[model samples]
Structures are given as structure tokens and as C-alpha cells.
Target: MQNEGEWEAVRLLSTAARLVRREVDNRLRELGLTQERVTVLRVLAGDGPMKRAELARRLRVTAQTLGTSLVTMTRQGLVGELPPAAEGGARRVVDISEHGRRMLGRADEIEQVGFSADIRPELRRELVSLIHDLEVHRAGASASL
Candidate 1:
């Protein structure tokens, strides 16, 4: 009916996203990075240090999910934490380590190469608009990313 092409477009986008993730993950694996981890690093780099809960909220992930990622990242020396009592005495704050910053730079390079496909400018604009619209539509006014 009215949703004939819509479903196929969404399915294709989903499939393409998964394929891109897989390809990028494989490349990032060599640098001890994943797209998810890179995203965390990027956000920290942009927003500066933030409490654990705040970071989880900004990333739109559960605290428990972020906790697991933090464990591994902490062990890898990619992130540093300031204890609650040591800082404002509230909650632990997380920041990207210098190592994480350096790795993020390398990851950016790898990602650039991976996404080197030359899409038309119009297509790029459409893709961005589509993503923004979808986020707004799905999450209402809270999708400010």
C-alpha cells in the first residue's frame, strides 16, 4: 500500500549499515578499536570529561552497557576515571586518555579510507537529511545528535 517502497528502503539501509560496520570493524580490529569504542572516544573528546551516567545518557546507551565497555577500555588505558570522592564527590567521571586520543586519530584515518566511496553531493545531503529526519521522527525532540 502506502509503505511499499518504504520497507525496502529501510531494509536496504539496514543491510548496508551492517555490511559497512562489518567491514569497518575488521579494519579497526587491527588497531584495537571498534566503531562503538571510537564513538565513545569521539564524544568524550568533544564534550570533555563527564560523569559515567551523563556519558551513558549522551551516548544513548545504558549505564550497564557502558560499564562493560569502560572495563575493557580502562584496562586498555584508553580511558581514565576520576573517582566521585576525588572530584565533586558525586559520580565517577570519564575522560579519554592520551592514548585514546592518539588511537582515535588513527581510527579516523582508517575510517576515512573505508568510507572513501564518492557519493554525489546531493546523495550525501539526502543521506544526512534522511538520518536527521529519522532520528527526530523516532525519538521526538530528544534526538539532538
Candidate 2:
């Protein structure tokens, strides 16, 4: 039901997203971090400690996927699991460590230098608005289902 222009736009957006992700991942690899891991760290830095289930939900990934990432992060000492806030609680809380915060700060600087320079300010704002609108619509559609 979409026109050629619409299809082209979708393709361009998908390709651009993948390219950006690849570039960011490549840069982060030097620091032994991935974009996903940085995202988790950023969320934890901003939101404080959170239950694994809640973190998984916010990340829009399955618990198992997040758990796998957490396992690696834990072993690396980038994150730590906290004891349950209440006895017999099923949820495990995860918090970013001081090292994680340092890494996240470095990641932010890297991203700013690597990513922000490529996009014009106006275009970046427009893209952000478009993505926000799409997310809002997607959430509404999901809620209706």
C-alpha cells in the first residue's frame, strides 16, 4: 500500500540506522563495550538501580537476552547485582558500578565526536521528532492489540 517514495524512505532510514550502529559498535569495541551495553549503562546511570525485569522491559529486549549481557557485564565488573530489597523477592536489582560510569562517560564523548559531527543540527532534530512520533504511534497500536 506504500508508494515508491515511501519504500525508499524506509530503506534509507533502515540503512542509515544500521550504518550508525555499526560505526558506534566498532568504536566501542576498543573499550570492550557494545552499543547495547552502553545503553544499559546509560539507563542505569539515569534511572538508578532497577530490577532486571524492569530493565529488560525498558530496553525492549527479552529477559534472557538482557541476562546474557548482564552476565558478561557482571564478570567484567561493569555492573553489580544487589540483594533483594525485601526477603523472598523474586526480582534482582542491577546497578552500574563506578567503572561503568567512567566507561559511560567515555562512550558519551566518543559518540559525540563520532556520531554528532556527521548529522546537521536541523536534520538531527527532524529525525528525532520523526522517530518520536513513530514510537508514539507504535505504542498506541500495541496498546490497542
Candidate 3:
């Protein structure tokens, strides 16, 4: 029972998200950073050191996916992992290195510049609000299934 208007809304949102993601990814690539790596850095910066499983949950990705992402980030020196305790050895915890904090600050600057240049300053708040609402609804819809 979907109408043309509904379908158009879906397409518009999908396309806009893809375009935004592509621009961000392209910019990060210039800095030798991947989307997942940037996300890892942001999460660590915000939350501090956390267990691998918890990180995977927060990122809404599989543990294996996170493992692979972390390997690349670790190689890039953006993050570091701590060894298990000699006692009840738990999973490796992750933390952003000092270098990562510097890079993240740089990334934020780049993102702000890109957004200002490409997106209308006036629509920025509404666009952010729309994306947030979509995510909240999507999560609720998924859980109801």
C-alpha cells in the first residue's frame, strides 16, 4: 500500500544518507582514515576505555566486524589495546591513543569545514533532527518485529 510520496521519501532519505557518508568517507580517506576507524576514535574519545564487546554493541556491528576494524586502526596507531589481567583475564579493552585525540580534533575541523561548504547552514539543524528521528524510529520498528 505504499504510495509514490512514501517511496520518494524513502529514496530521498537513502540518497541523502549515502551522499553524506560518501563525502565524509572521502574526506577521511585523504587523512588515511576509514569510516570505522573514525567512529572508533570518536567512541573512545567520548566513552574512554571500554571492552571489545561493549564497543561492538555501541557501534551496532558484529564482534568479528569490530575485530577487523580494530586491527586496521591499531595498525594505524589510532588506538591501543590492553592485555588481559593476570587474574580473571577478561577481553582486551580499547582506548584511543594521544595521537588519536589529536587526529580526532583535526577530523572534526575537516568535517565542519566540509559541512559548511556543502550543506546549507540553515538546514543543518533540521537535517540532524530528521536523521536522529529516523534512527529512533528505525530502532523501535526493528525491535517490534
Question: Residue 66 in candidate 2 has what lDDT?
Answer: 100
Per-residue CA lDDT of candidate 2, range 53-108, in tens? 99999998999999999999998889998887566765589999999999999999
- lDDT of each candidate versus the true structure: 0.87, 0.91, 0.85
The full ranking of all candidates by lDDT, starting with the best, is 2, 1, 3
In model 2, what is the error at residue 116, expressed in angstroms?
3.8
Q: Using TM-score as the measure, name the better of candidate 2 and candidate 3.
A: 2
TM-score of candidate 1 versus the correct structure, residues matched by position: 0.80
**2-109 in candidate 1: lDDT tens per residue?**
554667787878876788788889999998888889999999999999998999998889999999999999898999897677545766789999999999999988
Off by over 4 Å in 3: 1-7, 116-145
Give a tens-digit lDDT track for model 3, residues 46-129: 999999999999998999999998898888888999778888777689999998898898788878787435777667788889
Candidate number that wins on lDDT, 2 or 3: 2
Winning candidate number (lDDT) = 2
Please, what is the TM-score per model?
A: 0.80, 0.82, 0.76
On TM-score, the candidate that comes out on top is 2
Candidate 1's displacement at residue 126, Å, is: 2.8
Root-mean-square deviation of each candidate, in angstroms?
A: 4.7, 3.6, 4.2
lDDT of 2: 0.91
Look at candidate 2 and tell me the lDDT of residue 35: 93
Question: How many residue pairs clash in all the candidates, one count each?
Answer: 0, 0, 0
